[model samples]
Target chain A: MNQTAMAENKAITISFPEELSEVQEMVRACIQCGTCSGSCPNEFAMDFTPRRLWRMVLMGQKDDIFKSKTFSLCSSCYYCTLRCPRGLPLTEAMAALKQIAAKDGLSKYKQSSLFYKSFLESVRRHGKVREMEFMTMYFTAMKSPFLPFRFAALGMRLMGKGKVHIQIPSKGEGKLKAIFRKVEEMEGR
Target chain B: MNYLYYPGCSLEGSALEYNLSTIAFMEAMGIELTEIEDWTCCGASAAESVSHLLSLALPARNLALAETMELDADLMIPCSACYLNLRNVAEKIKKEPDILNEINTVLKEDNLELKGDIQVRHLLDVVATDLGADSLAPKIRKSLDGLSIAPYYGCQCLRPYTVFDDPEKPTTMEPLINVTGARVHAWDMGGKCCGASHMNTKMDVGMELVAAILRAARGADAVVTVCPMCQMNLEAYQKKISATYGEDLSMTILYLPQLIGLAIGLSDKDLRLDLNLSITESFRNKLNNDCVK
Candidate 1:
């Protein structure tokens, strides 16, 4: 191909923004040995295996990477990171991908992202996670009436065992307010 | 030896049995644990998915609180996820001074500062390493002999950071189990993933992994784990997993310290065994016959 043609082809391919520099740098050392995919416990559930995801990451296929639920399905087992001969931080990279998706407000990751948000919000309020409150907030935010029913049996069992405590929601001790505020200010969120 | 304890959010809630058993077992062993006052959450795995800085800052705040105590001792955590979160920040701050400085800036808001000098140790490390089999053997008031127990290490305790045990194949818990006079059930699922929060986010995937672990645990009288997430997953999902897989996958799941507490002559109430989801009658009978004075 001619120089102009090569430049045109490169421009047509989707490229990652500067935000993904750390992830890109980490994945650059991938030898494509498929050790990550082989080691991943949830690989069968992922739309794209970890190996293919790393390849897309290396090629800067940002759109394709975002469309797949590969990173969201990661259970953070760290098996791949441990087995990878290249010693890449695969688990951290997966977390980084989730962080970017959450920051960008991708629609596909709405449920999982909302779950994390509700969890942190509980922490922010009480300095500890009140499971009943957190799950209530999550179910409400999800707007799925049927979602609570799905977990109702387990919830009842836990409550029966005195595992779930019911307390009136009050303003928490606010122990983490300063830390959360400081982090928010630092991250400029 | 005395140590600063950070019982993350779960200990006060769903994993209260773990907290109860840990304190009882440690007291019996004569180890001192001073709870860190006014400590906040460690952000678990949730904070990282939301904000990396918040994840570091949340845990750093606790470390700063520990530092203020001037305990000159390690900060011990019982929850695997909390251990990973705190240890991750501690290791990062040690390797990169700038990250420590950045986290310190956030801690400044709470009138705290992290020196990044305190060591973070898991309860398993303290038990298996600090109190080895030699020290544990004589304390076995009730022998767990003939009870085939599977030692399940789960993932977080061993992985991403292989400080005290092998990430892939862990034998630390085995020796501890043997010291209780129990035969360690030979199994490869000890260090496997329990699907972590995926059980909440993606139920099918988490159930699949849990089913695999439970199936591999067959022939063992019970599965003993150090991490609360693993305990909850292995015990809570048996009915659903069995229904999904069309097999009897029920297995008794106990916290590591709970099992140790039993062998060390602690009562069932002390270990909170009733709080556990599944405890086989045979296993209970064995404990009653051998351990109960």
Candidate 2:
């Protein structure tokens, strides 16, 4: 709304940090509308709402954006993206933020990041996840034995119903491993 | 029609009932489903968070395998997350040939290439749309009369791409539910997020959201979902969510196939309804068909 400030600021094009260059397009297209924040289900839990986060991205506030859970809290429900008037890939932006956070060794949601790591590892090794194995690996990987006990009742119920499985994961182990190897080699991870 | 089926990881483990019910329902309907050989995880809720390329690649491998087999029919994925992953990657490969090429370079050594030729569809879509309502009507042996059903369209299947129905407000399940002779509860919370796998990552946040949907479906006899994660969170975690909210928000949750399976006179064993954590007395006694026996 400040024409004077806007006119003064217009001459200098702001460049985001190299890591955030991808989101510059998204931030530029943004109308500073709070629709994304308004539409987000987890907006109430977000420290800095998505609308404010976009503005921060424009201002090259990498530290602030990374510190905040705005992107990390995104579960990829696609509500904000679906509701965005600018037709931005808001969900993908959130995914990119997570990628950046991981790259920077900054995890806002520790539990979530750990879970993702454990789940991905399970798939990487077996080409399929056996629930019991996945949970054990997750708990062990996180070094928090108490967490599994928290869901013990529900876990037991799943087991009781014959839902919990122990199996020899078959079919194309060689090919599956090859895919993981390729991705790992490509990502240099 | 014959189709390549991708069950995903959840169905084999935590969401086994979804797998069983889907298979039973499909078999009863004469829909042949051959499980895609040596299928791996589609990286469901986690793969994308860690790495986008890994997320796309994991699902792409499965797609590539299906394509390699030359299974020409549309791929039928039972779980919503897998359906979304497969469909997203398949479309991505079509629209942005670069992504497919990127994946193929890795896949090349193994003699695999993600051609993205297959039409990835959800079990819900196959039954509701392809199988159709009119044809399904005659198949229902025991009608689900007097049961108010809430069709929970949890996040994945209907978002970013409105593959089968409206994203914000979906009614794809209505025709299927109707043909089974049940009353569809036209509630606003149908398309709400189930917080996905956040139930593990962010328990309090995820549980609260699940509680709200369960509360919204208060009047309905049962909430039927097409996604394993949705059904698991709503059913398995309902009690926990209830305790958190300090409300007795107990409700029965079933997969869409389970409801149709029951209506088609398929017994409890066939549908694996016993495996569901939240089988309400009303549902078990009235609609489960086991009561009739």
Candidate with top lDDT is: 1
lDDT score for residue A172 of model 1: 80
Model 1 segments beyond 4 Å from truth?
A1-16, A167-173, B290-293
Prediction-by-prediction clash tally: 0, 0
DockQ of 2: 0.58
Residues A1-189, model 1: lDDT tens digits: 997556434422223266577789988999999999999999989889999999998987887777789999988889999999999999989988888888776655778999999888889998888888888888988999899887788788878889887654567877688888988887766
Best by DockQ: 1
Q: What tier of docking accuracy does candidate 2 attain?
A: medium
Candidate 2 ranges with C-alpha deviation above 4 Å: A1-17, A165-175, B288-293
For candidate 2, list the clashing residue pairs, or say none. none
Worst 10 residues of 2 chain A by lDDT: A7-16
Model 2 agreement with the true structure over B1-293: per-residue lDDT tens digits: 99899999999888888888898988998989988897888988687777778888888888888986676698998788898888889878888888888988877756777767788988877887788888788887887788889999888888888878899888988988888888999799988988887788778888878888988999888999999889888988877777778998889998988988888889889988778888888667776454332
Residue pairs of candidate 1 with colliding backbone atoms: none
